[model samples]
Target: MSAPPPADSPRLDLLRFLERVQLQDLQRTRDWIAAEEKHAVLEAARRPAPPPPEWLIEYGIGTGRPAARVHAGSCWDTRRR
Candidate 1:
């Protein structure tokens, strides 16, 4: 084994090594996340999204109305008094 650096000497070799590893890991993680997003987008694109139901938009009333006046431009999930 080689002798350790003198106390006076700066220990930059470890820092450089760590920086390299950190950069590599960051890039790998970024690539992985990008791949996951692309896969999700592709899967979503492959499957046709169901069209919005006629009443789901026109009346916004499907489920039991908690309020008398259901707001327009909102889904049946949203209710307003």
Candidate 2:
């Protein structure tokens, strides 16, 4: 076997190298997260808010038994089986 590195020569070089690699990995991950956040913000700004529910606009004013109740009754009846 080859002689081991001298104890006085900072035998912890491997540990230091590993730590540097891990630090680089962490930095890359952080950069990716930042980029993703930026993309999400841009997408949100580009997309329009969804329009209000049709029922809300159509039934806003007084109407014969709100459409909801009518639909609910029919759904309940069908589920009785």
Candidate 3:
């Protein structure tokens, strides 16, 4: 078996390397979020607002003839079954 690394050896270098890799990954994630936000803003600005429905202006409540009502004890009632 090999002897353990000294205090000032490459053993501590692994920590530094890991830190650098993590920092690079964090920067990449931040850049991706910024790009996605910019894309969303551009897409929202390019989209047009939908026109209002025509029925809203012409149709009124109680303007048509009353509809026939079904009997309460009809076969359509599942609760009784």
State TM-scores per candidate: 0.55, 0.55, 0.53
| Highest lDDT scorer | 1
Which of 1 and 2 is ahead in lDDT? 1
Sort by lDDT, top down from the best:
1, 3, 2
lDDT of each: 0.69, 0.65, 0.66
Q: RMSD per prediction, one decimal?
A: 8.1, 11.4, 13.6
Question: In candidate 3, what residue range of length 10 has the lowest lDDT sum?
Answer: 72-81
RMSD of 2: 11.4
* Candidate 1: residue 70 lDDT (0-100): 34
Better model by TM-score: candidate 1 vs candidate 3 = 1
The sequence of per-residue lDDT tens digits that candidate 3 reaches over residues 1-81 is 988677777867897789999999999999999999999999999999876433222232365834334333323432311
Tens-digit lDDT track of model 1 for 21-61: 99999999999999999999999999987865444222434
Off by over 4 Å in 1: 1-10, 56-81
Using lDDT as the yardstick, the better of models 2 and 3 is: 3
